[model samples]
Target: MGIRPLAKARTSFAATFGGLPSGFWWLWTAQLINRACGFVMPLLAFYITEELDRSAAFAGTVVAGIGVGSLVAGPFGGALGDRFGHKPTLVAALGATAASMIALAYARSPWALIVGAFVVGVTNNATRPAHNALIADVIPGKDQVRAYSLNFWAINVGYSIAMLSVGLVSFTGYTALFWLNGATTLIGAVMIATRVPGRARPAEPTEAEEAAGGFGAVLRDRSFVAFVGAQFLVLTILLQSESGLPIAMSLDGFSPSTFGQVAALNGIVIVAVQLPLTRLYKRFPESWVLAGSSATVGIGYSVLLLGDSAWIYGVSIVVWTLGEIGNTPTSFALVARISPDHLRGRYQGLYQVAWTGSAVVAPLVGGWVIHTWGAGPLWIGCLVVALAAAVAQLGIGTRLTRRVATKDPEEQPEPAKSAPASDAG
Candidate 1:
């Protein structure tokens, strides 16, 4: 291409992706690698029912174990990141999770599987707080939204790889899938340990922070706490797509392979459109963006109640994919708006806790509700929760802005000292 053409392209790229640190890109690369190898979760239900001869309820319980691990670990992990350093916590979480994935691959007994699941959950998701905090530490405020958007985009791209490949791998056996996931997890761990310096720990908290007391302080922030509750409800509704939707497809006589194709639609759409959508949401209030997203997600799931055809499912996927595109980056930016830099990890963890808890409860609740009551009621309940959360989000904007306005001047939102070079996809 001509030099002028190349120059134009680079300019466009920079506009879409605000300058973020090289460290953020390294973290993004690690996320891409790790999620690309994630094979077990999406097909876990099928594995349990077909290979292990277990009920959907059993599968739900196993999956719920992951949530239990994350629930316990998230905030604590965040605290560790703040106290000890983000890098070490990330390395340890990845290592432990790698071991858990291997154990899960080999386990045959229910108890073994459940224990494995719990360990995987604990180790697997514990990195979230540290990882998120590190991003905040590295990236500038002006670019935080795009930075998070790109990160979320990379994740779905990895999921697209997993979704497209895992079903094909199933014929060779799940043992291969589990081992591959472990290998990648370990690789991602090594990447961060060596490439991202985790040597710098935060200085001791100021007297105010010391008195407020970490988790106690995070809990007492009423606006943030309310936002967490809203997020928790929305997540409980949306996570059903991951846990229950595939199972319902299976029960309807769709093979795992077929279901994989249909389910991949979500990731495909995300990979295609999330960046453009991210740009669009940047123009609106985070609150309105979030509320609209929650409602759209509910509408997407409710569509599932209408029919089971490939086309119907495809339409539903598009609706919710748009919601997913908006919810995550906006939520991260919102969190940053109200959080003190020193307490960012704890705040991220509290946010992590909200959604991770949904993963724990949604599957078990969704599975049983689906098992006893049927898919229709489950969809209805999901829609109801989604709408309620949407309403709650509208209130969040008011509270979040109020808190932002009243925080200590030094604690208030400020532009990053400077931004990194912008880049497009």
Candidate 2:
């Protein structure tokens, strides 16, 4: 933690970015645009409730519809990525997402909003897996962790900017915010389609690879199944913050602004910590890191049960963010490592299906729990869920590590190689 060591860590992170493949910068650009637009959800919800004259409950249902659309789209998107290639899929998804956002902006009725949400959800959810599969195709194995971390960092930065912009502009009109969101998505689509080079699919995989059968075959792998399950639970715990934490914090006398600040802090922490930690953990066993991260998140939420003050809650956010930084990139890297080359998109889609499915359920359930029980009970319930996920991680950690270690070396990309530095602007 000394200045010298911190400087070294920073240098390492900087160097890793310097080494990313050519297409990565385009992917990063698209991610930034997508995430900046992503920050409009809170404003979107506000617009639905205040301007559209929808009840809060109805708005929540529309949001849940978005999740359902994403869940339904994931596997198909993954399959499409595997078949048609990542760049084409990314372009199509982004274009559709932008169009859907425009339609959503004009939606007048609750059903219309739901339909728009579903359209947006299906398109947007496809973007991630396609983008990730492209990265997995281009980047070296050792560099994948840094690539994912940088991607997340870009996302959080875009999110922070978008959130700030929405706050500033929504005073004018939420429709304006919606317009801006759509514009950004369109820009992202254009960037990916024109700027990023499409990854070349490996010369058609042999009969064995074909037999691997996309996500369906991937799902049958016991270790992969367990890993996906653990990821599902982690997402369930994370979604509670969006759905349950606000209600819980309101009950504890925290203002809406305070909740926003805490959530922003979570993003900032991830942006700050993810790269350095990814480097630090690169040499560690992925499974152990995942298990420990899960345990940390459970501990953090449990600590929230003891807190009534803003400072205490802030500390809990830090703890949970640390856990997030530790878990997410490693989990993604594992997926990339284990999946068949042709099926990376399919696997990522399946993984995202787990995530979106949890989003669909966690909010409704968390909201119901808050409405029925209270803050204390809700926090305890989240803690239990986190711990359960941790236990699941513990059960599968050894098996996953073994699977990773025993994999044929030829399946992985070469050791990390430095790319030529970008032109100094």
Task: Choose the strongest candidate by TM-score.
Answer: 2
TM-scores for all predictions: 0.83, 0.88
lDDT of 1 by residue, 336-420 (tens): 6578766777898899987878876778888898899888888888788889999999778656755654663343333223312
Model 1: pairs clashing at backbone N, Cα or C within 3 Å = 13-423, 13-424, 14-422, 14-423, 19-420
lDDT of each: 0.79, 0.76
Report the CA-based lDDT of candidate 1 relative to the real structure. 0.79
Off by over 4 Å in 1: 1-10, 42-62, 103-113, 167-177, 197-199, 243-258, 304-309, 364-381, 402-425
Question: Residue 208's C-alpha lDDT in candidate 2?
Answer: 82
What's the number of clashes in each of the models? 5, 0
For candidate 2, the TM-score is 0.88
